[model samples]
Structure formats: C-alpha cells, structure tokens
Target: MPLPEFNLYPDFNTVRLSHAYLNVSDLAASKAFYCDTLGLQITDESETHVYLRAMEERGHHCLVLQKSDAPGTVDAVGFKTYDEADLDRAEAWFQAQGRPTQWVIRPYQGRTLLTSDNLGIPLEFYHKMDRLPSIHQKYALYNGVKPLRIDHFNCFSPDVDASVAFYNSMGFRVTEYTEDEDSKRLWAAWMHRKGGVHDMAFTNGTGPRLHHVAFWVPTPLNIIDLLDLMATTGYVDNIERGPGRHGISNAFFLYVLDPDGHRIEIYCSDYQTVDPDLEPIKWDLTDPQRQTLWGAPAPKSWFEHGTRFTDAETRDSDIAASPIIAP
Candidate 1:
C-alpha cells in the first residue's frame, strides 16, 4: 500500500503531545527518579498520585505517576486540542470513526476526552490545562538532566502503516519513516502536529507498547551531566542507550529506565519541521546507520522491551526486518 496522504485540514485542531499517565509501584521512589534526578518539577501530589511538569512547560503537568500494583504499565498518552471546541470536535471525530469516546474528569484539566487510536493505544485529549509560571531560568532548581520540556513519544506498533494512516487522517504529517527493504512497507514512522520531528512515532514491534517518552534538554552537555550523575548516584544500571545521535531525527539522546522501568529519553538538537510542504525523510530497514548516526548499535532490549498499556493485548508486527543490535 502507498503512504497515506497527509491531512492538512481535519475536523479538530489537535495541537501537541502533552502528557503520559503511568502506573508505578512506589510513588516516592519514582518521585526521586523523575523530579530529583530528571529535573521535572512537582506540580501537584497526593498519597495516590503525583503530577510533574518540565521546566519549560506551562501546563500543570506533562506526566502523571499514579500508584499501581507495579511499574511499567501505561494508562494513557495525552494530547491537547487547540481549544475547547476542538476538544468537542475531537470527541466527535473519534466517535465518527467508530472509536469509543468518553468525557472524564482529570485534575487541573478541563473537559478531557478519552479514546484510543486504531491500534488500541489509550489516548486522552483535553484543552485548558492549568498554567504555571516558567522556571526555565531558575538555575538553582535544576537537577540531573535539566529537561526543558516534553518532546515526543515513541510507541511500538504491530502495524506502522496502519498507524501512520490513522494518525495522518487526524492531521499529523509524516516527518520521517523507515521502510522494509524487501517488502517496501513502512517499518516505522514519525508523525508531528506541533512541528518538531514528531509528536509521536510508531515503530514496528509488539502492539501498542510505549517505547519511551522524550524530553528536550538544553543541549548535549546536559546528557553528559546526567551520565555522570547516574553513574555515581547508584543508577548506573539504569542507563540503557545512547549518549549519541539518532540517524532519523539527528537528536542527541540518552535513554534511562526510571525506578519503574519506564524508559525516558533526554534529547536535544533536532532541526525544525514547521513548513507545511516539508518532505518526509525515509530510511531503509537494512541501513547500518538508520538507528544510530554514531556510537554502538542499540541493545536488543532497547527494541524488544517496552512498557505495556493497561489491559491492551500485544500483537507482533507482520512485516519485520533486523536492524543493527548490540549483542
């Protein structure tokens, strides 16, 4: 099948990737890793839940860690609509597509619409999140990596082509994609609404698992600092992948497992993609440099292991190709 046409106009104006709702066994331990170590600030907290915001995010939170039986289960991935009217239209749009939709109450957010994509990945849409004062210049408050803001999410999908088409119909533009050399089918895709490289990405793998949530850092130097901190502070084993550049986005990255084993990437230095007519970059499945621009190949766990969504069933990708993996 051919690539889906990018929908420049849609029924609703969905804006950006906003937040993730995660389930963790220990709130305090997760708090130490996310706030004390990663530099996100506490927006709100209770015995059962905690909300976190990046230094540059004005919204009440970009992450929510809620107490659960264990770590590494995702509740939902969130995006913000352009306005309340858009949120209403988004609910209608999902309903019109035969996807279930519901209105739910969330703290500090207005009129949240809960639904799922074609892949059954849980998603939440809202507008009017409570705003907070910027703390970007509060240098003393900066911690481990000094993350500036939430950047994007990478999801493991059973069908990258279907995912690309589904999201494309929702007005996301494809920015980059990887295709299987033999089948010429999409193996992975990066789609954007807020116009960086991606607001979300889909990689060919098990169905509907979250690979990682990326945060924008000040520079590559911040990643170096995080490496040193994790090394001495008893989190050496948590350091999973690159302090290297990705061939796809040209992003400098470092992946670390939080206390709950959820992956988070501290990232920076990708170029802009704001122009409407920008062409999507493609990589072949067999390219040696497709996954990494430099440094060692990603470890096997990096591709195979990902956090499952609560109650979602897993499906293996129909089209598969071996990418370079560190043994």
Candidate 2:
C-alpha cells in the first residue's frame, strides 16, 4: 500500500511533540533518575510532583512526574499547536470526530485540552506555556548525558498501520517504517513533524503502551558516559538495551528504565525529514540490524515491556507476526 498524502491544511496546526505525564512510586527516586542522573533541570517541584525541562528547551517543562501509589502508569503524552487559535481549532477537530475532550487547569500551561486518539492513547494538546531563560551554556550544572532536548516518543501500538494512517491525517509525515514481509504490512513507523527523524513512532505490540520517551543528546560520547555512570551507581540493572545504532533512523541510542520501569532513550544523529514529499524508508521485519545496526541483540523485555497508559482500556490486536528476538 502507498503512503497516505500529507494533510497540508488540517483543521489545526500542531507544532511538535511536547511533554509527558507519568506516575512514579517515589518522588525522590524518580527525581534522582530524571534530574540528577539524566540531566533534566527541575523547573518546579511540590510535595507530590516535579516538573523537568531539558537544557535547550525553553518551555516550562517537557516531563512531569507525579508521585502515585500505582507507579508506572503514564497519564498523557503531549503536543503543542501553533497558537491559541490553533488550540481552538484542535478542539473543534477532535469534537468533529466525536472524541471527548476537557479543558483542564495545569500549572504553567494555558488551556490544556485532554483527549485521545482513535486507539485511545491519552494525549494533551496545548499552545501556551511559560518560558524560561536558556541554561545551555551552564557548564557547571551539567550532569549525566546532558540531554539537550526532547526528541520523540515511541508507543506500543497494537496496530501500526492504523496508527500511521491516523497520525498521517494530523499532518505527521512518515520518515521511515518497518514492514512485515510475509504480510506486506507496516510493522513499525517513524512519523514526524519537527523533522529530525520522528516526533512520534509506533511499534506493533500490545495496545496503548508507551515504548519509550526519547531525548536528543549531544553525541555518542554521552551514551558512553551515561553507561559508566549507571554502572558505578546503583542503576546498572536499569540498562535495558543499546549503546548502538539503529538502521532505521541512523541514530545512536541507549535505552534505560527509570525507577518506575518507564523506558527512556538517550538518542542522537538521526537525519532530517522536513520535506513533505520525502519517501518513507522501509525495513523488513526480519532484518536484525534494523533494530541495532551494531550491538548485542535487544532483550525480550525491550520488545514485550512498556509503560501502561493510565485508565486506558486494553484489547488484543488482530494483526500478528513473529520477528527476530534476542536468545
């Protein structure tokens, strides 16, 4: 099947992927992982919550950790629109599709719209956020891999093809995708708006689980430093996979689990995909190197495990295929 046409004139303009809300078992532990180890600056914090922003991000926050008894549940992944008018347009767009939405009061954000996609992945869309001075040049404040910005989010989609088609309608273009050879179906896709590989990616797996939230780091050296830090610290066991390249995006990566088992990827070096006409790069499901161009095979947990979406109902997916896995 051919890729869907890019929606040039959608009802609203979504600028790029924004923040993610997650529930953590312990605020102190999660803080150590994100702010101390991962190099995200704590923008604000309270007794029950902490907001974090990357070094280069001017937004109030890119990730929010909420202390909860039921840890490992993701509240929502988010995106930003062009302006307040676009937020209004977005509300109409979702309402047109009969998707329920709510205007919620969020700290440091203006008029947040809480909604979901056709697959029921919880999403938050907003246009306004408080800004902060850049701390990119603050050498002394740097810690762990020194992540520069939020890169993308990958989700476990029960139906990859459907996920691609749906996001395609919202103006997210396909940069690359993995195909199921026997079925000739899309097994995974890297869809983007901000253009460095992907702002979002979907992998066929169980329904509505977040595969990993990725952050762009300075270089491959950062991954090496992070590995050393994890080994010396108490988090050597948190390394899930990588310190390798992905054939699909050509990005070097390292995946680690947070205290709550929420997956985080330190990534860099993916090529651009800004041109709307750019054809999608395709990989067969059977390609071993597609996942790791050079490294040990990914553990089974990398494929089968992910952060569950809060209050989202799960269902079995109809499409099925067997792909390569680590022994």
Candidate 3:
C-alpha cells in the first residue's frame, strides 16, 4: 500500500533525532563504555543517571543512561522540533488520534511531550535543551572513535508500513526503503527530518525494540581506529558487525555492543538529502546488497536481538508483538 499523504497531521514539524534514553544496570560500566571507550563526552551526571554528547554536539546530551536493575533497555527515543509550538502541535495531534500523551519537565530540557507511537514505542518531543561548547576542535581530548555527533536511530516495529505512515505524518521523509520481492509489502524504511539520509529508521521486527543508535564519526578510518581501540582494551567481544558499507544509505558503518548490551553504530560517509523532489530509493528484501554493499551477511543476532523500550508513564515494558513477515 502506498504511504498516506504527507502532512496528514498538520503542523507537525520535527527537527531531528536529539537523544535516546537507555536504562542500564550499571552506570559506571556504561560510562566506561560510552565515555572512555567510545569517546562521548560526559555533559552531566548524578548518582542515578549520566548525560553524554558527541564532540560536535551543541546540545547538552544526545544519550542518557539511567540506573536500573533491569537488563539494558531503551526508555525513549527523543526528537527536537523547530520550536515550542511544534511540540504543542504534536501533543494535540497525538491526542486527536487518541494516543496517550503527557507533559514532562526534564532537567536541562524545555517542556517535553511524551507519547507512544502506534507500535507502542516511547517517543519524546521537545524544543529546547541546554547548549554546550562544541569540542570538535579539541583534538587533545579526543579518544577512541572520536565520534562527532549522534547521527540516527534504527528502531524495530512489527508493522513497517504503519510506522512509516506515522512518521511521515510528522514531516519525516522517506529517503530509502525495502519491500518484499513478491508481495511488495513494506519491510523497512529510512526516514529523516534532517538533511542527511535518515535521522530515524524503522525495520521489520518484533515490537518496539531499539535496533541501534548511530553516532557520526569523522571518517571510515575512525571506525577502524575504534576497532583497534576496542581490541586493545579487551572489548573485542563487543564488536557485533561491520566496518562495511551499506548499499541502502551508502554509509560506512560499524556496530558494537556497550557494556550493558545496548547497540551503537559508528557511521560515516552518507550523502545529504535536501532536494524536496528527491525520490525515495527502494530495494527488494531479497537483495543482499540492500543491507550490505560488500556482500557480508548480517549475523542472526543482529536480526533477533534489540533492546526493549519501556512505557514513558507507567515504566512498564512495552508488550512485544508479532512482526508481519513477507510472504
């Protein structure tokens, strides 16, 4: 089925993916993985939580780790809007659809609206965050991959078509997608509010789990350097996949597991998508190159494992649903 017309929900103008909230069992261990090893800078921290950002980020944080006894899980995926009114528009639109919504006062952030997507993935919308000095030129402070900024998030949804439609209504444009070869059913989509390929993507999978949150490294060699650092630091087992190119986005990428088992990707070399008339690139699900340009198959774990998200208000695990498999 074709995607619903764009702007189905009027005045919903999301700017970009801003941050991802994760529940981790050990804050210290996660800090070591994300900060010391991955090169993210610690912006703020408390006994129960830590806020981190990449070198190029002006915002206070792009990733938040909250202390929890449960296994590592995603708490929410956050997006920034053009202004505070855009967040109000989103809240009203979601309420009109009968989705539960709440206003939250988060530290270092302006007024926030928390809601769940159709698939029950926790979503947050906000307009303001505390700004910090960019550390891109601070070469002496760089370490590991020396990631520049948080790039994108890949999430799992049982219904890819519905997820695409939901985000499309929120002004996200599809830059690339995959569909079943025979049935032509939507399997996955890369959507964006920013100029690059995708600020967020949805893949065909179980429930509202998080596949990975990506950080933009300066170059492909940065990915290699991180691998070397990981190996030297006895974190070789954390390497999950690639320093390979993806035919879909044409990005050089590497995926690794943090100490809490949450996945993060170090990515580089993707083109911008600023043309309004740009047609979305489509791929057949059976095409190996759709996922990897170098013909490397993704591991079974990559397909089956992802961090579950918790409900924003109730703090309960979102129920997993069966995926719509292509015939």
Candidate lDDT (C-alpha), each: 0.91, 0.89, 0.85
Candidate 2's C-alpha runs over 4 A off are none
TM-score, ranked from best to worst: 1, 2, 3
- In the order shown, what is each candidate's alpha-carbon RMSD? 1.0, 1.1, 3.8
**Model 1 Cα lDDT, one tens digit per residue, 43-102:** 899999999998888899999999998578999999999988998889889999899899
What is candidate 2's lDDT per residue for 144-229, written digit by digit as tens?
A: 99989999999988888888888987888888888777777888899988877899999888878999999999999999999999
Which is the better candidate, 1 or 3, if ranked by lDDT? 1
Worst 10 residues of 3 by lDDT: 313-322
Provide the lowest-lDDT 10-residue window in model 1.
Answer: 287-296
Off by over 4 Å in 1: none
Clashing pairs in 3: none
- Lowest summed-lDDT stretch of 10 residues in model 2? 314-323
Candidate 3 regions off by >4 Å?
312-327
TM-score of 3: 0.93
